[model samples]
Target: MAELPKSVSIREVGPRDGLQNEDPIPTEAKVRLLDALSRTGVRRIEAVSFVHPRAIPQMADADEVWQRAAKVDGVRYSALVPNSKGAQRALAAGFTEIEVVVSASDTHNRRNVNRGTDESLDDIAELIDLLHQAGATAEVIIATSFGCPYEGDVDPARVAAIVDRAVRDGADRVAFGDTTGMGTPRRVRGLITAVRDRDADIPVLLHFHNTRGTALANLLTALELGVTEFDASVGGLGGCPYAPGASGNLATEEAVHMLHDMGIDTDIDLDALIEVAELAEELTGRRLPSGVLRAGPRTRLTASSG
Candidate 1:
């Protein structure tokens, strides 16, 4: 087995990505969730997205949520933007770390943002400039990097080309998203290799959904490939509004438990994270699909029969 990195950074996207698919919660609840996540020792949090209210009603209160959040001392917060307008809104909300997303598959891109792949890339190039002008860093997230529900198979070379374009347009970092959880170990390796072959210096983050039960396997493969940054949600709460049949994101507490057992450090409090996951279940009024939440962590013990 390839040696794993000593430590990794897990960005919690529960408050934003996780809640966007559920029924709209109160702005106060969003603020409370952000505050709770900040206290869980999660260093990075994707707090909100500045999209139009009609598009994602759950995120309609993005401005109020950010204004009311208890920004912690050591935790870095970021927000997602769909276009130049969204970027401006995020900047106005005092966000220094902003993420913009474009899809690798044209069909998915069209369905996601009502634009073709090339059109979104063109917009992203301009959006990157807009973000930089406001003294904020821009990270481009490539959705459906592995495979697309609409397009079926997404070529790795196509994903590489998108990454190349985003990097050339001055994106500080790039994230590969398994938009419909269509990633396996082989697909993850191919996509990472393709991206690295194009640009080895750009920071890479992996966002996986457990829709097909391959999220953790893909994470392990990325780890072996030296990809250290990842995005996870508390209580496995997330699904793309545009992608039908897509499930929740990889569970944060479950990932932390596996990483800790492997001697890899994520600096996240597993117990505290589980508590937050439970809170998420309570808030959503549904049992989330998290293995660690259901079966307990690996350290849990039971009495043996004599």
Candidate 2:
């Protein structure tokens, strides 16, 4: 086993990524969900995505959700933006940490954002200037960085090149997304090395979906390389909009479970977070894929009452 880092920072993507793939929930309920997650000690939350309502009806109330979430103390709220208009909405919503997403594969990019990779980069450049001018940082999430369900077997070099372009366009950080759980431990280690080899200044984060049952293992590989930040959704609530049948993001509860078991502290309350996941299941009215939620954490035991 590789020597791992002492702690990892988890950025909750439940409200945005999680809800985006599901049927739209009431705006007030979304706010309540954020409020509950905030109290669970998740320091960074992707509160909302400022996308076109036509594009993602789940986030139609981005304005109201942002307005309500901006009031939380000591928690950093981020909004995912796709273009100049989304950035404007995020800025107006008072999100200090904004994330923009673009797929690494040309096919996925075109299908996802309706633009080629070049056009998406240009939009991100303009959006970064806008975000930075407002004293906020822009984080570019490179979607399908590992592999795409439609495109299949994305090149590591290609993923690195995308991150390089985003950095050149002034992204504060870049997150590699395993949209279809197509990443292996070797791939995880390779890409992390490749990106830092290109530019040591830009920090990297991982957004993983547990589609192929490899998300947890991949995360352990990243931990060995000193990756300290990640993206996970409560109740494992998310899926690739492009990868139609792929599973959702890695469960926040499961991530914390494995991390804590490995003696790496995440400072997250797993029980409390599981409760948050329960609320998510209730809100979405769907059964979640979270293992810890179904089996319960190891710390909890049933008493013998014979």
Candidate 3:
């Protein structure tokens, strides 16, 4: 087996990507969730998106939530934007790390932002320039990196070309999102290899959904390939609209548990994170699908059984 890194960084995306899919919760509740997550020793958090309210009603109160949430020391926060206007909102609100997303599938891109893939890339170049002028770092997230529900199988070269354009446009970092949880170990290797073939030095992040239960398996593959950064949600909170009744993103507590057992450090307090995951369930009024959250960590289980 290939050696895994001694330490990994998992950016918590529960507050932004997770809640944006559920019925709109009170701004206060969202603030509570963000504040709670901050205390869990999560080093990085994707806190909110600046999209139009009508586009994602659940994120309508993004500004208020960010203003009210506690900014913890040593924790880095980021916001996502869909366009130049949204980028302006994030920058004005004092966010230094901003993420912009465009889908690799043209149909997915059109459905998401009403623009073709290349057109979105063109816009992203300007957005990157806009962000850079403001002294903020721009990271481009390529959704549907593995496969697309609407387009079926997405070619690795197509995803690679998107990465190429984003890199040429001067993106500081890049992430591949398994938008519909369609990624597998094979697809993960293919996509990462394709992207590296284009730019071997660009920073890469992986975002996987647990829709088909391959998120962790895919993570392991990426680890072997030397990809360290990842995006995960607390309690497996977010579900893709395209794949109803399926599992959400990989659970942070579960991922932490597996990583810790492998002697890989995440710098997250697993017990504290699971508590926050439970808090997420309470605020959302629904049970999440995190096995580790429900069953406790391996050491905890072993101790109890003993």
Candidate 4:
């Protein structure tokens, strides 16, 4: 059996990816979520995105939201962008760590950015150079890394090629997005192996969705493979807008609960996180899909009727 990591870093995406799919909430609500998440001991959060208002109206007020949200000390925040213009917006908003995305599947890539994957990568190379010049670190997130809803069964070599190119283009880090929750242990292992064969030391983050109930299992497989960073959303919020049947992301509290039970350190307060998840549910006015949030943690004891 492969060894599991002693600790893991969970980046909260509730403020950005989580809300991007929901109806546009008030900017105050967005700021409130950002502030609450920062207090949950999660060191990293994807605070917002810099996309055109017409593209994702939910993220239209990215600037005002980030400006009003209280930036806690010791917490590193990141923003997602779609293109050079979006990157400029994030930089202007003072985000040092920014993320851009491309899909491994050409069909999905076109659906996502309205352009081919190669074209987006070409732009990403220039975007990375621009970010570097501004003393910012660029992280390239490759969506549909496992399987595409339209094409199905993406080749591991294709994903590997994207990783190689992104790293070569000076991306400070890379993440594989399991868009539509199509990842399995076999797929995860194959993809990670292919990427590792080329570059053994580049930092990689995994983003999994719980649409098919395989998110946690996939996470365990990744842990066994020595991946320590992951992206999760509070209250299991958000999914890919263009990918049909894609559900919310893996719940942050659920992942943290499992890690803590296994004696793995995440440095997050489970109780506090649950509280914030409740807040998220209240803000969204809908029931989220987080099992831990619904059923509580495993350690909770009920009064016996004996």
* TM-score for predicted model 2 compared with the true structure: 0.96
lDDT of 4 at 298: 94
**Model 1 lDDT per residue over 188-296, tens place:** 9999999899899999999999988998999999999999999999999875555554566999998999999999999888988998888888888767889998888
Question: Any idea how many clashes model 1 has?
Answer: 0
- Poorest 10 consecutive residues by lDDT, candidate 1: 239-248
lDDT tens digits, residue span 186-290, model 4: 999999999999978889999999888899999999999999999999989885565544566999999999999988998789999999999999998878889
What's the residue-level lDDT of 50 in candidate 2?
Answer: 88
Output the TM-score of candidate 3. Answer: 0.98
What lDDT is reached at residue 210 by model 2?
89
Could you tell which candidate, 1 or 2, scores higher by TM-score? 1
Can you write out model 2's per-residue Cα lDDT over 28-77, one digit (the tens) per residue? 88988898999888888988898889878999998988677635677788
Better of 2 and 3 by lDDT: 3
Ordered by TM-score, highest first, the candidates read 3, 4, 1, 2
Task: Please tell me which model should have the higher TM-score, number 2 or number 4.
Answer: 4
Ranking by lDDT: 3, 4, 1, 2
Q: Give the Å error, residue 281, model 2.
A: 0.9
Candidate lDDT scores, in order, read 0.91, 0.87, 0.93, 0.92
How much RMSD separates candidate 3 from the native structure? 1.3
TM-scores, all candidates, are: 0.97, 0.96, 0.98, 0.97
